[model samples]
Target: MRLYKYYRPDFYFEKSLRYDEIFFASNEQLNDPHDLVIKPYFGNNKEAWKSILKSNAPFDTWCLSKIVDIDNDNLTRELNDEFEGVVVDDSSSISSVLDNQSASLAQIFEKYLTPQCNAMFKKPEAASAACVQFLKEKLARGWDKRYYSCSFSKNPLEPQMWAHYGGGFRGCVLIYRGLSDGSINLRNNIYISDSQNFKFADVNYQDKDKLVDILDLNSRVNIIEQNLLNKSSFWSHEKEMRLLLSESFGSIRVSIASGMPKSTKTQIFHHAPDAIEGVIFGSNCSESYKEKITSMLAEKYSFLLPAGVPAFLTFDSRLTSQGKVEINYGAKCIIREVRSSQVIKEILENERLNTMLKELGIPQFN
Candidate 1:
C-alpha cells in the first residue's frame, strides 16, 4: 500500500519535515506531489497567485504511484543501455489507450510500490487507503494550517503531476458528500490560460511569511480559471475527466469537490450532457443552476449506486457514444451533494478538526 515518492527539494523539503510526512497532492501541487497534472495552470498566473494568499479556503491533495520493479537497478541499467526514446507506432485506438486501467492489484502497483512494500498489500484499494491513512494520521498529529494546509498523479514525478488543466485549481468533482469515489469532469477541455509570471521578486522564501504568501497566490487562480471557461465554448465532444483509482460508488476516501463560477457551470449544464456528473460545490451560485443540480441529484444514470445518487463523471454523456450509461447496481448509495457552500466552507475552513471531519462525512480525513 506504499508508493515511492519524490519531492521538489526547492519547495517542499522543509515544510514536510515539520510533519515528518509527505501528504497527498490535491488538484494543486502546492500541497504534495501529484500525478495527473494535465495542464500546468499556475505556472504563469501572477494576479491569481496574490489572491489565494489572502484567502483561507482549503486546498485539494493527490498521491501518484508507479508499479515498482523488484530488479529496479538491473532493469534500469538495462533500459538505460537499450531504451529508445520513441514508442513504436501501432493501431491502438485512443479509447483503448485511454482505458489503460489496471486489471488487478499486481498489475496496478507493480512498479509503483517497492517489492517489499507491495508484498504487504492484498488489494489496490488497500494501497490507496493506506496513502490517505498516512496523511490523515499526520493531520491527527496536527498540521499548521498556515503552512501545511496545502495539498498528484502517475510517475509521481511526471511533469503532468504539476499540471492543472490550465487553471490553478482543477474542477475536481468540485464538491461532494456521502460519496468520495466519483470524480469531476469538464467538457471542451476549456480553462483559464495565462502566460504571466508570478515568481517571487528575486526574494528568498526562507523568510517566515514567504512560503505561505507564495501558496496564497493560488486564490484567484480558480476564479480566473472559471472566467476563462466562460469565454470558451463548451465542447460536447469533450469528456476527458475520470478518476484514476476509482473502484465503485462507495470507494470514498480523501475526496475533494471544487465549485466553478456560475456562468461557466450554466454553459456546461446546457451545452454539455451533464454539468458535473455526481456532485458539485457552489460558486456564484444561482437558483436555476441549483435546480439543475438538484434535479440531477435525484436521478440515477444507471443502477451503479441508487436512484437518488448522481452519476460519476466516467459516465458523462460526452465520454460515451450512447449519450448515457445504463449500468445498474443493486447497492444503496452513500455519496450525495451539498446545496449550500457557505455552510460547508464555514465548517471546513474552521480550525476545529472533529467538526470539519464530521461535515466531510468521513471516519477520517481522505
Candidate 2:
C-alpha cells in the first residue's frame, strides 16, 4: 500500500529548512545534491513542532533561514546584487529600501530552497484501497443511514486505504458516529461546532459560488464565536453554572426596568417585543439610582444580547422619601430612582428580551 503524509506548513518548513540547510551546508562540502527524506508529521507531532518554534525562534525566520543560508558568501553576494538592483530600479519612486530587501529575499529563497527537511520523517502506512473504498461509499450515503454498528470499535480499514479513496472520509465517518451517539452535534448551517471548534465543511461537491458563500459564512461565524469566547468565557462556564443554579433556584427571573419616559419604553417594546415580557417605567428616581440600574442591565445583557440592541438612558425623575420606585415584571420586580428617555428606547427594542418573553409563555402584555 502507498502511504501519503500531510504536514502543516510550519512543520514542513521547519523540517524542510533544517534538512535543506544541512543539505546546502553539506553541498558546500561535497558539491552534490543529497536526497532528503519526507515524512508525514501527524496528530500531536505536528502541534509539537509549533510549540518548539513558538518558544525558540519566530516561525518565519526559522523557515527562511533554511532557504537562504545567509552566511554563504555566494548567496549573500547574490542577495546584495538583487537588493541594489531593486533600489536602483525604483530610485525615482516613493518605495522604501524595505521593499528592496523583501524582493531580494524572495529571489534568494527561490533559487536555494530545498524540499522540507522533515520529509525524512515517515508517516504510518495507510489502509490499502480495497479496505477503505467500502467505507467511503457507505459514508457518502449521509449520516442517518451511514453506519450499521453502534459499537465504538475502529473499523479494520487502514488510513492509506481511506486516503486512496479520498481524504477526510475516515475523519467524517468518526464525526458522524460521534454525532449519532450524542457525543457531537453537526451544525450544518454553521461550519463550527457548538464548542467553537471548526469542521472542514464539504467543499468538493459544491460549485464555486456556493463554496465561496459557505466559506464566507463559516469565516463570519468563526469570528463571532471567537469574539464572544474572548470577551467572556461565559458560554463555557454557562453549562456548569446553569446546572448549579438550577439546583439552588427554582426559577431564574430577568428584570427589565428603566427610568426613561413611558413613550420611549412603549416604542422599544413595539420594536423588540422579544426582549422582555413587560416593561415598567419608574415614576420617580434619583440620578444615582438610575445609574445603578443601567449599569446592572448593561452587565447582564451586554454579552447576552446580540448586536442592534440600543442602549438604555436615564429618566427625568428623582427619588423622593419613598427611597425606591417599584415595578413588577411577571418573572421579577425592578426598583429604580431615576429613568432616562434612551433607556426606554433600548428596553423596548432588544430582541433577546423579547425572546425571553416568549420563553415564559406569557400570554398577556402588561
lDDT of each: 0.25, 0.23
Q: Give per-residue CA lDDT, model 2, range 138-228, as digits (tens).
A: 1111111100001111221222222322132211111011222223222212233343122211101111111111112225334322221
Model 1: worst 10 consecutive residues (lDDT sum): 141-150
Model 1: lDDT equals 0.25
1-366 in candidate 1: lDDT tens per residue? Answer: 111122332233323322222232223333212122111111322333223222222323222222233233443332222212212111111112112321332233333454444555776556544443332222111111111111111111122221232121111122222123232222222243221111111111121111111122325334322221221122212212222211111111212111111111111100122222233212222445434433333342323234333433211001123322111111112334443211111112233433433433322211
Candidate 2: Cα lDDT at 236: 22
CA lDDT, candidate 1, residue 50: 29
Supply the TM-score for candidate 2.
0.16
TM-score of each: 0.18, 0.16
